[model samples]
Target: LAKTTQPISMDSYEGQEVNITCSHNNIATNDYITWYQQFPSQGPRFIIQGYKTKVTNEVASLFIPADRKSSTLSLPRVSLSDTAVYYCLVGVLSGGAQKLVFGQGTRLTINP
Candidate 1:
């Protein structure tokens, strides 16, 4: 199990790509880093998840270091709607239950 560390706040202009980084120095061997986005008063929405190297999807891309100690979430051409709290977490199975351990989310403010 590992705890993540990320910035508390970030600012970006509309139509610009935004990248947020998370650090997990003591990550386990079989851990997956998952990223989420949550708007105010709304539940978190799954963004992306990865194990090693790079994983890209339609919405975002996840880049992980070889040592699995850190990851970066990249959003291309972000807009105002992308303003939200971004979370980095590690999903693990505990006693037949899946548990998501997350760090303090980073609040991203997208301006026009």
Candidate 2:
């Protein structure tokens, strides 16, 4: 199950909420949905993770449906500094280890 899809880029004004959606139509039952945010020249930072329904963190909120086929990462009141590449990933436990496959990330640009 490697099929994942996301928008290439998005533009938003500061102080607005930003939501990035990812599609994983072939997602497995045991897989978990995770999101990561990366700034220029910096490693990706974990945002949130969820298996179903909704999970909220200080930085973002993750929403996964009961079908588990897709997820959305929502950033509240984003600022210019929040501009970054957001990655959606599916992780599964395999052979006593965690395996994650990532898809093309969405580049979010927060404007003034």
Q: List the residue pairs that clash in candidate 1.
A: none
lDDT for predicted candidate 2 compared with the true structure: 0.87
Output the worst ten-in-a-row residue range by lDDT, candidate 2.
91-100
Q: In model 1, what is the error at residue 1, expressed in angstroms?
A: 8.3
lDDT of 1 by residue, 1-112 (tens): 4456899999999999999999877666787999999999999999998999999999999999899888999999999999999999975455555567797999999999
Best by lDDT: 1
The lowest-lDDT stretch of 10 consecutive residues in candidate 1 is 91-100
Report lDDT per candidate: 0.89, 0.87
- TM of each candidate vs. truth: 0.89, 0.89
| Residue pairs with clashing backbones, model 2 | none
lDDT of 2 by residue, 1-112 (tens): 4558899999999999999999887666687888988998999998898989999989999988888888999999999999999999986445666567686999999999
Output the lDDT of residue 75, model 1: 97
The count of backbone overlaps in candidate 2 is: 0
Error of 1 at 11 (Å): 0.1
- Name the lDDT value of residue 70 in candidate 1: 86
